[model samples]
Target: MYRTSAMKQYQTVNIQAQTSGASPHRLIQMLMEGGLSRLAQARGAMERGQIALKGELIGKAIGIVGGLRDGLDLEKGGELATNLDGLYEYMVNRLMQANLKNDAAALDEVSDLLRTVKSGWDGISQ
Candidate 1:
């Protein structure tokens, strides 16, 4: 039998919390965990250059790690774009998809992106 949405959500969260560090594995783990707010935080990290994809700074991990690459690198927090307008927009879309469809895959995708961003901005404060 297929897992229920609540069950899926629980699984996703568990994965995120359990996984630490900036490994790509942890990023994917977080997506499955479920949390738009966390995702947004990650995005902010990426835009600021606190996270690296393929060893280079990436503003949008979504374009790169959709399904490819072994993993990503996460730095501490730092300043992102003066205006985080676009990043927020995409995050909302991802959050909706995860909530409405109960799509763990989609959540996983967005979560990775967020983690990359979060890693980049690990040290910086809002």
Candidate 2:
């Protein structure tokens, strides 16, 4: 219990630091990183047979994807935004499947997709 609290506090502080003075592109990158990190954790939890923790982590990943989707500026991003929304929806569905079935492959698939997107995003100079 003490360790969990300390970890949460550490994460909270880390997040606050990351967000402070961040540009829009940087914020999106952070969200992608956050989702990827959660998915990795969910995979580890699944390997450990920690069902509840796996679900929690998967849920957090889904929320991060949803946030990314929601943050898209359709007017500015145009077709790319639309495509990303579809991809995010697919990712969320796969995450739900992973949670329900303890399917590590599904998690891996989503993680790969997110990494690909993140890589592309990283290439853009902002």
Specify the highest-lDDT model's number: 2
**How much lDDT does each candidate structure score?**
0.41, 0.83
Q: What digit string (tens of lDDT, one per residue) describes model 1 on residues 29-82? A: 444233444445444544454443211212222322222221222222223331
Error of 2 at 59 (Å): 0.5
State the RMSD for candidate 2.
6.0
How far residue 19's Cα lies from its native spot in candidate 2, in Å, is 5.6
True-vs-predicted CA distance for residue 100, candidate 2, Å: 0.6
- Residue 66 CA displacement from its true place in model 1, Å: 22
Q: Per-prediction TM-score, please?
A: 0.34, 0.85
Model 2's alpha-carbon lDDT is: 0.83
In model 2, the clashing pairs are none
**Deviation in Å, model 2, residue 78 alpha carbon:** 1.2
